[model samples]
Every structure is written in structure tokens, then in C-alpha cells.
Target: MNALGALAAFAAASSLFCGATAARHSYAEGDKVKLWANVVGPFSNPSVTYQYYERLPFCQPLDGLVHKPATLGELVDGNRLVLTPYDIAFQQNRERVTLCSKALTRREVQQFQAAIRDDFYFQMVLDDSLPMWGFVGKLEKVAPATPAEKETHRISLFTHMHFDIAYNLDRVIEVNVSTDSSRTVDISEDVTPNTEDGTIRAEFTYSVVWSPTDIPYAQRMEKYRRVQFLPQHLEIHWFSIINSCVTVLLLTGFLATILLRVLRNDFLRFSRDEDAMEDAEESGWKYCHGDVFRFPPNHNLFCALIGTGTQLFFLGIFIFLLSCVGAFAPYSRGSMYTALIVLYALTAGIAGYTAGSYYRQMGGTAWVRNTLLTCVVFCGPFFIAFCINNTIAIAYGSTAAFPFGTICIIAVIWALVTLPLTILGCIIGKNTRTDFKAPCRTTKYPREVPDLPWYRSALPQMLGAGFLPFSAIYIELYYIFASVWGHKIYTIYPILFIVFIILLIVTAFICVAMTYFQLAAEDHRWWWRSFFCGGSTGLFVYAYSIYFYFQRSDMSGLMQSCFFFGYVACVCLGFFIMLGTVGWRASLLFVRHIYKAIKCE
Candidate 1:
């Protein structure tokens, strides 16, 4: 009860914090609106980003104002916003204001040319609400006038920016940036990089135009929600979902028919005829009942995996539900990540309880080790990946790197809150644990498993079991990958929720069938086999990720490659554990049910 109360309070506080932050964007008239320069990267690869002024010879704000401290969400999203020198009052228009004028050195000129040639773009924010994007410069190829004439390319920098701010009454609703082509300076003519000292000076300027609109503040973000590719994505998403549902339906029907006919016949034959029971040649699942209830090896690790998987399952459902209900703003930077981190910390008790109870049920005496393993099962690999990714980011001078303070904060949360709660739950679980209570008693001697066909091997069964689940979500995985590694913004949470359910159902059903086959083959070693069978879906997912990286995405560079694979490996590991637990649980219930119905005496 105390734990429940504490969880409720923490949730309430988080809700309040999110609500307060949402309203911070609203501003009164004549308020000093702050402009923030965010990140710059190659337009072709969205994952590769760096500080806006990292290599640019741009002027900084002379006021020396301290940068706004980033939120947890912001840090997770790799958004670092620094105040720009641009000064503009809310709802007040400014015309042709000079930002900076400086003579470019030869190296600086070459840098600008390189940026233009590489199609670099920068991002900025207004009042920390509206985001604006623009290319660094334009590259054009001059067409040959005659057949013998050679075509030449020209590069020009956009020196002037025109910002159009739309307002509804007093609150800013929309922001747009337009570059004036007429105000561009020819880079080849004005900026000569061949000279020892560049003679050309670069003048950067901007203008603001405020326009009132009837669009409500609540609906200001509608523009971003209207993605052009959304219709196509929806079509694919729905089709894949329907396909998965049909597969599940067929699988369930097949299993049900087999149980009703084959299993019923076997049970009736065994129960009604004493001759059949005495037949030494009788070979089927009934023969394996003696050794089926035998305790599995490495029960501690199995318990931990089940516990952590249970925790992740619940966490996924909660996060998906919240997202579907718009509890977290989709456009809010790092909001999803922030929620995930906080909720994962708060849910540590669930993991501990699950692992501890299962450990006790398995007749294990090492409660402390079991509890510790549960706590670190998912987080352990994730932490290592986070460290590697952060190190790569820091080396590349990318904004994706988490600051030391943020890392310390995360560590503090884990130590002070997560650890204690997990320990408490472990204590409760240990006290409340009941016996395993398998319907059948294990035989003193283990049954010798007969050699089966190559197709009935563990490896083949795992591969077959995982393929269906992977097929269910492969289509949606593309959109997720695009959103994470590409430039797309993912907001289709309802569909995602549906697909998640479908994946779980498919995994559960497939694993149940696989276990039945294994048992029917007179193999009593279904414990770890079921787990590997279910978790093999993660292997498929990782394989698909490899395909996506090489064929589907434009992501490149060593840093991005490392970051992608590192984090994805962690995600796949979690997926493996989560689904593996599901499979094991489903198989356990099935095994218990079939054995309980037979004459176990």
C-alpha cells in the first residue's frame, strides 16, 4: 500500500511538471522573445548533427547570456539550444537588421564553400517552441549555351533571413523562415579562397514579419502533424496489421482443432483402455509426463529473465497507452525518452517482485543474487550501450552526448529510488511466494530423449517460431527506424499500440505451438527451448535493422553507425527477454493444463 501510494504521488508530480512546462511557451506582448541556434548537419543524413557554430565562422551573442539549462527530454533528444544574437520583441516586426559583418579568411571561405557543396543545413528555435530549418547555401550548375561550351557550377550564400511569425491574439502560433534569393552573395565572386587574405566581407542579416491568424494555440502544431507520407504509411501499417491478425487466427484455429481432435482422442484412449497404458511402444506427449515437471537448470537466470520481461511488458503497455492518449506531447523534444527513464525507475519494484517470486517458486535459496540480477537484467546492457554511444558522440562533438551532470542525475535516481524500491519488492515477493505446484510429480530417473529429424531440432524450431512475430511488425519497423534515424516525425501511436498487441499475441501463440511440438516429440526439455524460441524474434529484428541501415537509410559515418547498432542491440536484447518470458509463461500454462487433465497417478 505504501509503495502504491508513493508511485501514485510520483506520477502526479510528473504530470504536474509536464503540464507546467507545456504552458511555458505562452508569452505576453512586447516580451523579449529568445532565439536559439540548435544543430547543423548534412542535409542528407539527419542522424549526424553537430553544434550549429562548430565549424561555421558565425558571430556569437555579445551579451554573454548563460545558456538555458536543458531538460531531461532535451538532453535525450540531443537538442542543445544556445541563445542567438537576434533580438526581436514578441508580435513586433523588424526590417533589414544587420546581424554581423566580418571579412572572411581563406580558411573560413573554404569552409563556407565546403558547407554549401555538402548541402549543410541548420536548425533554430523561436521562444523555444517553433523550429525553423534552412540550408547553409545554394549550389547551381550553369547550363552550357553551346554544344562545345563546358558547364560550370556556382555557389551562393543566403545572407538575409526573413522570418514570418504567425500569432493568434497574443500567443505565437506559427513560425516560418524564407531566404531572399535576391539578397544572396555569389561565393565564387565575393569570397575568393585562393587569395592569402580574402578581401570579400560576409554580411548576415535578418527580418521579422508578424501576422495575426485565427488558428488557435492548441492547434498551432497541426502543420507538423500533416505529413505527406502519412497516408502511405497508414496503408502499409493497416495492411500489415490485418495480415498478422489473419495469421494469428489461422494459428489459433489450427491449435484448437488439434487439441479438440488429436489430444481428446489420445486422452480418451489412455483413460478408457488399460491395454494402451500398458503398451511399452506407446510414443507421444503422454510418455514425457514423468520428466516434464523436472526443475530446469540455471533456474536463477530464468527467473530473472522472466521477471525483467514482465516489467518491460507492463512498461511498454503503459507508455503506449499514454502516448495514444496524448499524455506526452509528440512534438515536445525528448518527452518520450524522459517518460521512459522516469517510469522505468519507478517500475523497478515490478521487476524485483517478479524475479524474486519466480526464484522462490523454483526452490532457489539465493534470493539476494536473484533480486540483483533482475535489477540489472535490462539496465546492465543498456548502460554499457549508453556509455559507448555517449563516448562516440563526445568524440564527434555531437549534441547527442549526455553531459556528466545528466549521467550523475540518472545514477542518483537509480541508486536512491530504483534500488530501494526493487529491494522492497523483493522482500515482499519472497514472503508471498507460493509453491510451483506442478500437477505431475517428477520421476526419479530422467527420460532418454530419442533422436528427431533435423527439422525438429532446437535451432529450426526457434527460427520458425520467431518468423511469424517478426513478419507482424516488419512493416511498422520501417516507420520507427525512419523516425529514429531519419528525418521523419512519428506520431502514429494508436497504430503502434495495435501492432504491439499483435506482436505479443503472435509470439505467445507461436511459442505455445512450438512447445507442443517439442513435447509431442517426447522431448521434456521445453523450458529453455521455449525461451530461445520466443527470443529468436529479436534476432530477426536485428537482422532487419542491418538491412534497413544498408538499404533503407542514408545514415553514414562511424559515429552514427556505432550509435545505431549499439542502441539497437540493446533494444533487441530487451525485446528478446520480453518475448522470451511470454513464450515461457504460455508454454508453462499449456504444459500444466495438458498434464493436469491426464491420469497422472
Candidate 2:
């Protein structure tokens, strides 16, 4: 062959040779193959790694089934098929095989198990619930196998689907499986019935060996083992539990201390004196003697803060509950959050109007500030999340998330749907008013809030308030953020959501107790103390995130997106919500204490 013609002839010959090699490698039904492997890279520091390995087929004996008993059945089937179901233990019927690796922590273990459960096995009749191209596989049973290294701790399970589907299904290699056990099998006999459509029902069952290869080794300890190599960053659920209990304990202590002192002074020292605290309260909380509701909080600010805060609390509660139930698990599209935020804002018009009117009734001014604060405090985080999502959009080179157009659409919806409704609510609330007649201790001027050591100041106490809530659930928050920004696939949003609720309750309780304690200490500066207690937990979350970032590895470019303005919005929202929580508690307590000390005429 000369030049061009020679090259063409050589290319045709090479193509034919490659095609033949591929056909030979194709796994045939009756053929026995040892393995499939990847000798190269899936890329450096891969999150989803590709691996190829040996495929070992295993099966269960067919002794219990009513069978045809053909010559084939009579000859070799009886030799090994003598496994009895009722009398004999199943441990022997099911065999074990080895796999490449194991998981280490609970998250890793969960991921490992789920990988197998969600994986399709042959003969599994995974129905129309999935698309035509859905993954389909079958594996009858699972069992632990011999470990390659005892210290390394590897274990494997035998999946019988391969044994049954191989065209040469007759010969049993230590064990045998039938088409019946394989889910992908298309046998006419529908012996196993799924209650729901095959596609709709989720099958989640798998077992795998879990071992931590790198341990307390110096370098490993500094790196991977620091977070302990979980499949997720940190699942917020577990950490929330520890934090909730601690918060409860601290709040209980504060309440008990205050209530005991109040009781002792009233019953013992004052000897049934109804006015035990009121006796010398003129210089204390009673100092706000004239017009305790001095600046009736902008008349519109009233219903706006209370109504909106209440709604936010309930919405937050539901979202967290859903999270705890795994609704927002890692595989779920993050778009759901955007959807939720949108829906919440649309529905919050009622709360907004209620608050606006209340503030108006309370003789408040600055209508613009009131309206703006309502939107900023309640709907602002979503704005930032939108931006972060946009950054992600840029990174992904797609506008699947809240694009600029979508954001404008959302803003319009909020304005048209929620804002008008809120204004209407304010108008309605303004048309009606209910008198709140509560007893209080009267005084001439505001009480000079106690001045003392720096430790007792509202600034320091606010810092303390933040600590407990953070302590109760910093770890849980870590896991949640990790799943989101760090791109860890998670499936336990519902459960973690419960932790969020518990965190809220615990934070609120702690704030109430701490606010009371500060009041008792003659620190009537409730505004700052209130914000400190509830808002401080976010600070802990921020601090912990930094610590975790240094420790985490193998990220999908999360570092760049994490420090952006979008994340700052998340931080700010967390702080403000906490601030609102503490402020609300302080306001309520301020009203209660003043009423209790008052001598109504």
C-alpha cells in the first residue's frame, strides 16, 4: 500500500480487530468470567469513583420449591438441593463473596448500604416507576465473607441474581439461585407481589463491611480522621441531640434559680407579702414607670414583628421536621429550598399585614422602615441563597436555579401576592383593637439599668446566650451545610429538621431564662440580652464551619463558593432570626414582670 491507500487499508484492519476483541469480551449468558477492572484514573480526588472488579455468582438451593423433577433435576439438583427451609437454619443456604472495600462511619456505612439497595440486580422486576432506562439488578441474599486482612476488616455478601440469570444455571458453585429470587426476572408467575407499583416502592436493604483504613496515624489523624471520613460532612441530627440536651439543662438551671429566689423572698422573707418584689422595684424594672410601652413600636411594627415572627417559627418548624424525615436528602435537587422560600413569602402576607397594623396601632412611625424590616428580616436570606445559587449556576454554566429572570419573577410575586395581602391585613387590624389590661408597678422615670463588671453586661451575656444554642446543635448544622455547600449527597433532611425545631425551642427557652436572670440582676437592658441568647448559635455555626473547612478534603470546589456574599447572607439570616427570637422573648418578659409588680388602682 502506497501512502494514503496504505494508511486506509491499515485503519480498516485495526478497526476490524478492535471490533472482534470487544465482542469476545462481551459477557455471554453461559460463559464464565472472572472480573472487570479499571487500571486507570477516574480523575484525582474523585467523589464518585469508577471501579471495575471480579463478578462472582452465588445462589440458594431449590429444595423447598415444588419442582418438575426432570432428569436434570434428578441428577445433580438433589445432590446440593437438599437444603431444608423450615428445619434447617438459613446461614448455610446463603453463601458469601468478597467486594473491593468497606465503610467507616455511620454516614459511610449508610451510603455503602444504600449503594447496594438502590443498585439494580438482574431479574429484578423493577417496574414502570422508573424510566425505561432505569437501573435494574437482582441479588437474593447477603452474607459476610472472609476478610483479606483482619486489621483492615473487609467483608462481602453473596448476591444470587447473577447465579440464576447465567444461562448455564444448572451447575451450583457451592450454592444455587433461581429466577424466583431475582427481581429482574420476567417469569410469568408473579409470586412476589409489591403492594405499590414496582416503580413507586423503594427497596432499601443491604449489608457491607465497614472499616477505617486510616486511623490515629499522625498524618491521617491530622487530615481524614479529623472528621473521621463520613459519607456526609456531619449529619446535623446526631449533633442536634447532644446540643438540645445541654441547652435544656442550662435553661432549666436558670429558670430554677430565678423561680427559687422569687419564691424564697415572697413566702419566707416577706412572710406572705404579696408585694415582695414590688416593695423596692421603683429603681429596678419598674424604672420604665411612665408609659412602659413608651415608643409603641411604630404602630405598624407591632403586628409585623409578632405576626411575621410567629409565621416564620411555624414555617421553620415544618421545614426542619421535613428535613428530619429525609425529604431534602442529598440526592434531592436543592431547588426545593428555593421553592419553599418562595411559597413561604407568598403566604406571609397575612402575617405581614397583621404586624404592620399592630405597629400602626401601637403609635409607631417610619412606615417605610417597618415594611422594609419585614421583608429584610423574613425574606432576605432567600435573596442571598438566590445569589449563591446563581454562582453555582455560573459554575455549572447553566441557569437551572434562580436565574436573574426567575429572581425578578419571584420579587414580583412577593410584591404582588404577599405585599398587598400584608397591607390589607394591616388595614384590617387597624379597624379593630383589643384592650390589654395587665397589672404593673408604676414609676416616674426609666430604671437606671444596673452597671457592674464587664462579665455581667448585655454584650457578654449575649455572647453566652449564643453559646448554648450553638453547643446544642453546631455539629448538626455542620452536617447540613456540608451537604449543601460542600456537595455531599444526603438523604436525611426529615430527621435533621426535627433537630432544627429542638434547637429553636431550646434556644427560645434559654433566651427566656437568661433574659429573666439579667432582669433579676437589675439589668433591664432586655433588647441586647434577648438578641444575644437566640442569635449567638449562628456564631457558633460560623466558627465551627471554619474549623471544619480546614479539616475537610476532596471538595468539589466548595471553598470558592463558600466564602462568597451568598454565604454571608446565610450567616446574616441566621443571626437575625436568632436576634428576632431573643427580642421577642425579652419583649414578652418585659411586659410580664412590669405587670406583676404593678399595683392597679
Candidate 3:
């Protein structure tokens, strides 16, 4: 009895080994597979590529019905599935694992019929949404297999598994899928179910036909873009741009009027006539000529903020221009992010020099402290936020987390490339003094600020003033949020760049206007307020981000929430710094010019 059991076990092991060997042999390299599709679209040329199944799967588990459990390939450490492109194509027809509706119930059949009527369809996801190529070659059916052909089994063809468009007429749509080869054949009718014996059943027919084209890869890529934003949506963006432009134009007219007439009269009288000058000086902005150029409190920190802001401003412009020129194409996943990091690193010199020069000008003796702070102020927050997001992603077992090696590389770039470059920038800025000097010296004693109304208060004015800049980009913001979180494509970067310029112009105009009003009210504390006023636009942006998270996005889970909010905060902080600096610089120039033209002792 023991001998018999041993012999049986040995036979079972032998059979398992042979089955594994046969499976491996069926999917060898250089084998061709026919592509098939259940439903085709108006554009039927499918984009086919040999992609590793482990990296990008054709389909994944969606909510609802359980699929036929068939594991064709092995997964390595739950991070990646160990699969070759050949193995995936080999298992297409042979592996009878359906993704949705494994055993179609009567209700499911009705639902499918309804979905088909509504023009529901499937799309291929290679890197992004790839368009399907149709077949147009001659038909060549396989003959009945002999013993030899049966033993050496051939691989089946693969195609996109997209659904058909809804046709209300008969609740069915005709689709023609194009392929490279001409072996066209109709699928077996038996594969589809017919209503019989009080049971309603249905199945899809996946067929392949041969079609060929002589288009280059680059040309073809334009048609086969993934997750494409519809061209019709451009109208909405144009409308937003037009509306924002109208608002900006009106604001510009108001500023133009103020500068050309009202301020011009004040400057003329204050500079030319003794009586008119005294009257003007006694009442408005002309009175504070001596104190307008007063150094702001905590001058070192103020200068550092200005320096960092300048760096960010230039960095943003450089990146937007690059994107507009297609340096980072929408199809190239993560290219924008990579470009941003590299550019930021290269521009560290700008930040360093600006901070160093300003700190020196402000009479800051601690160069080391100022330099270190300049480097860390923005980067420190970003680094901390990134670490937090990475930690959460790691805990959630998300692929979004950067590996240790990547983290090390980033750190090295910051230390070796970004820091040293910033130092170099600082040296240049220190050597290069500004041509426009302050007309009056800063007083030893600070001016006493008077009580102000609620409307004129810094915080209230900032909050209200921020909305215009935010409005200029709110429409674009929606698309950007969609692209970042929804995994959609944002190719309309030219519009974005244009809007960016509009935002900057509007911010500058508003800041100058607000500073003029503040200074006219005898508030020499315009230094910090000017910075915060324009910077407040980022606050509105953060508010919009909150709105997007709660109302617009479909993202769920604590990890995702944390990641979204954390990163947005960092972005807003950077934006705030950049915008504030612009406002401050504009106010400085305005104050300096006015003071220089005035009758100052």
C-alpha cells in the first residue's frame, strides 16, 4: 500500500512539472499574437505596443462582480507583478478570466443592454489612453488542427477591450477594429448567448481584421494620446480668459487714470509751487516723502523674503515658457515634475545671491545665518511636506512613494548642486549694487501709526484684494487640479502661461494702488502690508484647493487626503512668498521715485 501511494505522488509531481513547462513554451519570445476587440469607435486604428504587464496592466479589479480567478503571471513583493509582454498576450484568449460580469445574470444582461444604448465604451490604457488601430488585411482562417499542430499550440492575437457606443435604435452599435494583418474572420455565434427557455443571456463578440498604415511614430502619437481633454473644452477656457481680461482691463484703466491724472497733479504741485506743495504735503502721500523709504522692521528677514520671492518668480516664468514651447509634453508622464526639480536646483544661485545681497544691504552681519535661512525657508517646508506624504504613501503601500535611492539622489542634488549655485548667486548680487538709491535716510525713531477703520486694515484689505488675482486663474486651476489628482492630461499650457502673466500684472497693479492708498493715509508700515497684500492671493488658492478636495475630486482615504492638503500648503506658501515679494518691490520703486522727485532736505 505504501509503495503504491509513493508511485501515485511521483506521477502527480511529474504532471505538474510538465504542465508548467508547456505553459512556458507556449509564450516564447518572437511569437505573434492576433488582436481582437469587442467594440470599436469612430476612429478604429488601435495603438499597439509591447509593454510589460507588471508595469502597466491591460485591466484591473474594479468595484462589483468577482472575475474568473486566473493568475497568469507572478507578482514580486506586491510592488510589481512579474510579467513579460509576451506572457500577457499569450494568455489573452487561452486565459478565460473575465474582468466584469463573469456569469451574467438576467439583470446584468439588461444593464449591459442599457449601457450599450447609452454609448458606453472601453478604452485602452497603455501609458495613458491609447487609441485603437483597426485591421484591414485579407482573411486567413486556421485549418482544423492535426496532431502535430495541436502539440505545438500557437499564441492568439490581442486587442483593446473597449465597449461599443450606445445606439438607441436597436440598442446595438456596429464597430470596426483595425489591425495590421489581413486574417479576418467572424467570431463563433455560439460564444454569444440567445434567449431560450425563459432565460435571457448575452455575450460579446471579439473579432480582428487586418489594417496597415505608414505613419511615423511621432505623427501617430498625436492621435493616440491618453486621457485626452476634449477640444470643445477650449471654449470654456477662452471664455474665462476673456472675462478675466475684461476685469484686468478695467483695473488697468483705473490705475492708469490714477497715475496719469491724480498722482501726476499731486507730484507736479508738490515739486513746483511752494504754497501748493505745502498744501499737498500737509494732506496726502506727499507728506511722508522723508519716511516712505524707511527700512522695514526685521530688515534682514524682509530682504531674505524679497530674495526668495524673486527667485521663485523667475523660476515660474522659466518653467511656464518651457512648457509653452513643449519642452515637457503632456504625453510624457512626470516630465513636468522632473523639469521643475532640475530647474529649481539650477536657479538656487538666484535665490542665494538675492538673499545675500539684500541681507548685506540691510546691514545683517550674520551672512552664514542669512544664507542658510534663505536656502531652507522654502525648501524646508517642501522637504517636510514631501517626507510626510512619502511616509503616508509608504504606509498605504502606494507606488507614489519615492524609494530610498531616489530620496538620496534628491538630497545630494540639493546639497551639491542647488546650495553651491545659490552661494554663487549671492556673491554676484553682493557685488552688484542697485542703481536707484533711496532718496531719504531712514529715521532713527519709527513713525507712530494711527488707528484705522476696518476696511483700511491690512488683513481685511489683503483678504479682499486677493480675490482678483485668484479669479484670473480659477478656471485654469480646475483643470490643473483635475490633471494632478484625476490622472487627466493638461495640454493647454499656453493658456496657463498667459493667465500667469495676467495674474502677475494684476497683482502688481493692485499692490501699487493699495500701497499708494496706505501711504497716503500716513501708514509707513506699507512694507509688510505690501508683501502680505499680494501674497494673500495664495491664501485664496488654498481655499479653492479645499473646495476642490471636498466637492470636485473623487479621491478617498486618509493617506490621499493628507498627501493632497500637505502638498497644496507647500505650493501656496511658495506662491505667497513670490507674489508678496513682487508687491514689495513695486511699492519700493514707487516710494523711491516719489521721494526723489519731492522737495526733501
Candidate 4:
């Protein structure tokens, strides 16, 4: 009861937080407009971000410092907003107004040069509602005058910014930033050692232009969706989805043929072959009926894995459905992540029930321990990786590091809400569970399994079983990776949902066929083997991530690499568990159905 109350409170709080965005305001003429600086990072690596003024020598606002409070999701997404010192009146044009004058030290000059060379971009908000982006500076290469001379480069920082604010009646609809190349100051020439007092002085200036537009404020975000290479991206996405659908059809047909023709013959022969069974002439899967339903080893861990997988399976479905329906706005900061965290908390009971019921069915005696294990099965490793990444982020002074308060809140939620509901579920599952009833009884003495060919072995079968499923989603993986590690916005949730279904169907069909072949080879250890066969797709995904990091992406530096691989490893781990459980459950049903059809003396 206490847990239920806590969960309700948390849900309400999360709902309010997620609903809170930049407040839209109706501005009158000559009203003071507020501007905010959000974050700055190298354009090449989107995940590596820092506070806007963290490494820059920018002037702070004089009339007391003010910061916009960030929500849980915003903090997690590495957004920190601080009011800038710029003064602008709504719908009032100003030209050549000096925003700040800063005396740059040698270090500050070097920082600006590095920012330009790395193509750093900064994000700012206008009227606390619209986001605008601009590059910090520019780097241009200079051709050598003589053929024997080496080429050099020049770095110039954008000193003047021109803001174009579009208005619709009393509301601001769009904000754009443009800079003139002629207004930039050459850092190399202005910051030479011959400068007086070894200090270079620079002034940042800006101009504002107000224009009226008929476009509605609601549709203002449409322009940001028009990304570069959009047509090519859509083409590849459609091709991949279509390719996956065809693969799923072929696999479904193949599995259907095997189930109808091959399984029918096996069932017919096994049901009418009493003489052959007595004479020890029976061969293949039917001969291993007695051992097929025998309990798998390490039943506790297996049950926990299955339960966690089931939880992830449902989580995936809900998230995709919500995204397809536009419940999570792609342009809204941290909306998707906030939804994920809240939903995962709410689904704790599902994991508990699944692990508990499956454990009870497997004749497990320690129900409490099983429930606890189920809770930690996925979160434990993820937490460890998160800690390591957070520590590294802190060391590098990146905004990606989670604040101490955020960590405490997460811990409290897990302990107070998620833990209690899971306990309740475990209690219910344990009390209401039924025994596992097998069609064929196991013999007192175990049967000796015959040797099989290399291709029929566990390792080989896992490799073969995982390849097709990986192929089904490998292309989609590229887009997902690009969205996460690059600057692309992924809004095609409907296609993602379709591809997700295709991947699952392909995984289930492939696992079922593999289990059938393993049983035909008289290997009754299909329990763990089935799980691994399905989970092996994650291995392929991680391998592809390695290739992408080196060959396909522009990501560099140690901090970025650690962040990429560490989080990707955790994702792959979850993927492995989820698909593994799917395969294991499908094989279990297939085995039971086949065994139930055969006659045993």
C-alpha cells in the first residue's frame, strides 16, 4: 500500500515535469526579451556537450545571475540554461550594439582557436521558447603562394551576431542566427605576442531584426526537421524496412513448411511405431521425449533472465506505440528519456511476476532470492556502467555527468516504489503458481546422447541462428546509431515499430527451427542453447558498433569513445536477454506440443 502511494506520487510529479517546457509568452512592443545560453559542443560528436560558457571567456550578466531550472529529463539530457547578458527589446531593431568587451588571455585565445578548428556550435533560446544554433567561429585553409611552401590555415572568431526573430501576432514563431564573414576578427593577427601587455582585447557585437510571419507557432519546429541528406536517409530507411519484411516472409514460409510436413511425418511415425521402439530402432527427436522436458540447469538464473526479458519486451512495445502516436515530441528535450524512466519504474511488477511464476513452475524453493535476482538482473550491470561513465564525464568536466541529487532521486524511486511492487508481485506469483507438467515422464537412468556434426553443435547453431535476425535489423541499426551519436533527429517511429515486429518474428522463427534441428540430433539441452541462439544477435550488433565507431563515424577522443562503447555494451546486454527469452519461450512451446503428440509406453 505504501509502495502504491509512492508510485502514484512519483507518476504525478513526472507528469508535471514532462509537461513543463519553455513557457510561451505574449510580448508587447518594447517589452524586454530574455535570451538564454544552453550548451556548446563539437559538432562532430553530439554526445559530448558542456555548459555554454564552461570553456569560453564570455561576459556574464551584470544584474545578478539567473538560471532556468532544469527538469529531471533536461538534466539527464545534459542541458543547462543560463541567462545571457544580451539586451534586446521585442520587435525593436538595433544595429551594431556592443554586447560585451573581454580582454582575452593567451589561454582564452587558444581556446577560441581550438573551438573554431573543431567546429564547435552553441545553442541559445529566444523568448525562452525557441532554440537557435550557431557556430562559435570558422577555420579557413590558405593555399600556399609558392609550390614549395607548405599550406597554412587561418582561424577567425565570429564577433558579430545578427538575430532574425519572426513573430505571429503577439507570439514569436521562429528565431534564426546569421553572421557576416566580414565582421569576424582574425585571432592569429589580433592575438600575436607583440600585443601590448600580452593581452588581446575583443568586442562581441550583435544586431536584431524583427519580421512578421503568418505561420503558426505550433508548426515552427518544422524547419529543423529539414535536415541535410534527408532524401537519402529516407531512401535507405525504406529499403531496409522492405528488405526486412521480405526476409520475415521467407522465414515464416520456411518455418511453416517444416512444421506442417516434417513435423507431421515425425508425429505419425512416432505414434505408430511400438515395435520399432521396443527393438531400439527409434531415432531422432522422438527418442529423446523423456529428457526433453527435464528441468534446465541453474533454473533460478534462467527464470530471472526470462522475467527481465519479458519486462523489456513489453517496455519496447509501449515505448514504440507511444512514440508512433506522438506522445513523445521528438523536438522536446528529454521527453523520450523521461518517458522511458517513468515507464520502467511502473513495469517493475511485471518483471517480478514473470520471474517468480517461472521460478515457482521450475520448482524453485527460494522465491525471495529469485525475486531479488530478477530486479538486479538488468539494472545491476547497467548501474555499474553508468557509474563508470559518469565518473569519466566528471573527470573530463562534461555536462553528461549526472548530478548527485539526480542519483539520489533515482535510488529512492527504485528502493521505495519499484522494489515494493516487485515484492508484492513475487508474493502473488509464488502463492498462485502451478507445477510444470510434462507429457512424457523422465527415466530413472539418463540416456547417452550420440555425437553430432560440427554444424549441429551449440556454438555453430548459435552463430547460424543469430545471423538472420541480425540481418533483419542491421540497416535500421545504422539509423538508430546515427541518431544517438550524430546530429540527426529520428522521427520515423512507425517504420521503427514495423521493423521491430519483423525482427521479433524472424528471431522466433529462426530459434524454433534451430531447436527442432537440435532435438533431431538428439541434443535435449535446448534450454540454454535456445536462449543463447536468440541472444547471439546482440553480439553481432556490438560487433557492428565497433565497425561504425571506426569506419563510419567522425567520433574521436578518449572520453567520446568510452562513452560510446560503455553505453552500447549495456544496450547490447539488454538486447541479448530480451531476444534470448523470446527464443527460449517459443522453443519451450514447440517442444511441448511435439512431445504431447507422440505416444510413449
Better of 1 and 4 by TM-score: 4
TM-score of 2: 0.54
Model 1, 146-208: lDDT tens per residue? 989888778888899999999887788889888888887677634344335645577899999
Clashing pairs in model 4, backbone N/Cα/C closer than 3 A:
none
Q: In TM-score terms, which candidate is top?
A: 4
Which candidate leads in lDDT?
4
Q: What local lDDT does model 3 show for residue 402?
A: 65
Q: Please report, in order, the local distance difference test score of every candidate based on alpha carbons.
A: 0.83, 0.43, 0.60, 0.84
Candidate 3: lDDT of 182? 26
* Descending-TM-score candidate ranking: 4, 1, 3, 2
Q: Compared to the true structure, candidate 1 yields what TM-score?
A: 0.93
lDDT of 4 by residue, 81-167 (tens): 899988878889999899888777889988988888889998898776577889988988889999999877888889899999898
lDDT of 3 by residue, 1-601 (tens): 7844743443343223222111212223223432222222111111111112211222322432222111111010011112112112321232222332233444544433333232233322221212233321122245657856623212222222332221112111122333323221222212333445433332222332222344433343344233344666777878778977987998899988776587888777666767554554266776666677666788777777888898899889867766655454433334455556766887888888888777767667777777777888899998898888788767744445666766787789899999898778877877785632577866767666667788999888898779888888898899888876654567777788888888888888888888988987888888899999989999999999999988886555566677788888999999999999988888787777777777675
C-alpha TM-scores of all predictions: 0.93, 0.54, 0.69, 0.94
Candidate 4 wrongly placed segments (more than 4 Å): 1-16, 19-22, 147-149, 189-195, 228-231
Error of 3 at 428 (Å): 2.9
lDDT of 2 at 36: 15
- Residue 300's lDDT within candidate 3 is 71
Per-model tally of clashing residue pairs = 0, 54, 32, 0
